[model samples]
Target: MARVQFENIYKRFGKVEVVHDVSFDIKDKEFMVLVGPSGCGKSTCLRMVAGLEEPSEGQIYIGDRMVNGVDPKDRDIAMVFQNYALYPHMTVFDNMAFGLKLRHFPKAQIQKRVEEAAATLGLENLLKRKPKELSGGQRQRVALGRAIVREAQVFLMDEPLSNLDAKLRVETRANIIKLHQSIQTTTIYVTHDQVEAMTMGDRIAVLNGGVIQQLGTPQELYDRPSNMFVAGFIGTPGMNFFPGAKVVAEGDTTKIVLDGMGQVEVPADYAKIARDAAGKELTFGIRPSHLEDAALVGEDSQRSSIDGTVDVVENLGNELQVYLTAGGKNIIATLDSRSRVVAGNKVKLYVENDRMHLFDTATGEAFF
Candidate 1:
């Protein structure tokens, strides 16, 4: 395993720049995920590391070597693409051993390596089967096995689980994590799915508009987003944003006034942050999970409650996602599965004050 570093990397196609001064370090044996929406340049960034694409400027390092001019084959990196690029005519064993064979490795060593990789990936019984004869999951495993047999210092996977069914994707995801753990190969994964990035990456780099918006652990990105875009993009159901809200001070306390919903008291620390911005427009953000049914909360709970008309109620077995419309603003609350709320019902929802996020109306930067 080796450390991978991108220093002020920029990529451009003609006059249109797709990547802008992106920089980050992937430690030895660390699983780093590059995640964003389509056209965000995540795949381009990964391609640069694999020597498939050259950066317009800046330098890239694999371990202690500068690999800017190195050929892809000589980079000592193995890449697993989105499509399982296996040879249909070759058996799994031959597919896995093709690289070693091309490099003129000994017959015994190739056999040993292929067998070891097959055993590691639980493909011992399917070594004789062709790619066309295997299931999607199996084919994907064969592709991964092909990479594993190389035993390269780094592994670059680009949406390797995108083609699998939902259940199969979950299974394959677990398998990939296990493989990384067992082998401890430095891995850089590219995915557009936030859930996959959150679950699989040791540290995630969130990109947008050809820029690195945030880089941190999943928990850090989820709990303390740097800006409105990061806050809204990293969560399931996204964050409910209420615009044009004002901060009002009552005595020594501060409160945020939601037009249709009642006032929500700010915590002391937040009150200090909001005091100078009183009467100015600000954006209010609250995650669905931080909102709960007020009726179910303890009486002594310090949460601030607001009233809204339920627009929809989705029961997700273990939890209920309640969509509400208050004062022309839409909000969603994720509550217990036992919640009895229904469409058109007027319900009281409680917000955890300390968990609320405030952003500048114009700049979209978080206030606290």
Candidate 2:
């Protein structure tokens, strides 16, 4: 029941800077996710918060107190790691109570806390079992249970589900979400997976090259990305980018000369913004799902449509990905998973104006 704050955090290892002026506020009980690619400094940022690595500059606050010089244990936060880090010789119960034992908590109090955490995590039956006898998911649960017994104000997790199998990862992900809802601890989960961030975070902070690209709700980031990098990174199949220029007219009409979809009228709300970039070189972005099959083009009269050859096909359960080349550019369309489309076939796809994103070709800044 505490808020975590990073104020202008900066981390550097010698001459190479890892995190650059990163700052964010995690409200009490908020499940904030830190996400990016492998070298994006997400883990370094998390480590700074956990007191494992001090920031080169800036202050970290836990609740109302500045904790920049505080030790990890005194910060009143519990951490779960990618590895279970369980003691092989100790039973699950002992493993969970180890922290309390080291802190000199009374035996009776430690037992009660351990039992409660194990029960909450469905680890009651595995209490007598050692880490070796437990499955990967079970071992992970023990690790989480160890943290839960401490009842810290904040929970810090670093890819806690990465070690599980695909099915188990999904299950564990759901479990973690449910656990957070029940306990309502302020959680800061760090991971390189955008899917996990989208599914788990109340708000996701997108990072790149040690800088935050965007910080907003999942829908906000997906619908209105601040820049080109975020627009291409958030979605499943991601947004398709192409070279184009805005088309403006005398009567407030706006459009783009897309090589594949042709010139389609921009949505009325977007006309003013779109008109600002007329005749200028820019990048056009559209989500794969934003494009629709020509035959089922709904009431979206502002959409641009064109015919193209499907270069490749990816059949997923609920959707099919059609790779197409248009206007000398390669683009992907994610249509109904049931759509019976294959590679090298001609098909019609449409991209509505409102769903389109425009970015300056030179600066990569969003034009609309």
Candidate 3:
């Protein structure tokens, strides 16, 4: 296990710089994921640490040693590429043993390492077969096994499961989690999918436009996001935003009336936050999961419910996704699986007062 650190990291492609002053630390044996949309410089950051790409500025360290100028192999890390990169003609066993053989490990030692790695990845039964004989998931496991045989200090995976089918991707994700628990090796994974990052990482770093927007444990980032981008990016179905809303004070309670969306009473603690927004434009945020069918929720102090006409219904087996247009505002809610809500019908929807997130429209920063 090793601690990985990036110090004010920067990358450049000719005169057009990509990554800008990026910095973060991955604790020893932690499963940390860097995630964002395409061209966000996440894969580029991983490549720099792997020594496959040089840092335009700053330094990268693995454990206590600076590895800025170290060769990729000498960095004592194993990388599982997205493409799998398996040799077409080589048997799975040879592919797993290739690195050790190149390093001139004794035949018995190489066999032991490969066999153990094969078993760990459940590839033992396919060792004699070539990659062409295997399924996409099986081939991916072979790629993982190849890295496992190295027993490197750190592991770097760059969207290795992207090529697998949805079901296989989920299974492989679970397998990777179990593998990490058993091996306890430090890993830095990069992906553009937020679902993978949330499920697989102990902590996630959300990146956008070549800079990290937020970094924290999955729950921390979800519950207490630092900014609008993160709040919107980290959640499934994303967070709902009503721009140019007005905050109006009603007696002791602080309230914000959304555009075409009804007024939501704010908590007393947040009253001061909304007080400064007399005539200024404000953005109100609410997560999809927090928006519930009024019949399913209480008129309690938790939230305020308003009426909406169902626009669409997405039945996702275990749960129902109800899209509605209320107060002239469009929103989605994950309702109970047995929900009888249908399109064109009207139903009451609750927007929790305490769960309301207010942001300055211009800066996109959450109002504390």
List TM-scores for all candidates, in order. Answer: 0.96, 0.95, 0.95
Best by TM-score: 1
Question: Can you rank all candidates by TM-score, best first?
Answer: 1, 2, 3
- Give the C-alpha miss distance for residue 52 in model 3, angstroms: 0.7
lDDT of 1 by residue, 54-100 (tens): 99999999999999999999999999999868988999999999999
In the range 1-368, model 2's lDDT, one tens digit per residue, is 89999999999999889999999999999999999989999889888888999999999999999999899889999999998689999999999999999999999999999998988899989999989999988999999999999999999999999999999999999989988999999999999888999999999999999999999999999999989888888988888887765575756556676654566667788777777776578887888888877766665533477567789988877778788887767888888775666687777777766788888888788876
Cα lDDT listed for each candidate: 0.90, 0.87, 0.87
Clashes (backbone N, CA, C under 3 Å), per candidate, total 0, 2, 1
TM-score of 1: 0.96
Candidate whose lDDT is highest: 1
lDDT of 3: 0.87
Q: For every candidate structure, what is the RMSD over all alpha carbons to the true structure, in angstroms?
A: 1.5, 1.8, 1.8
**Better candidate number, 1 or 2, judged by lDDT:** 1
**True lDDT of residue 134, candidate 2:** 95
Q: Is candidate 1 or candidate 3 better by lDDT?
A: 1
When 1 and 2 are scored with TM-score, the better candidate is 1
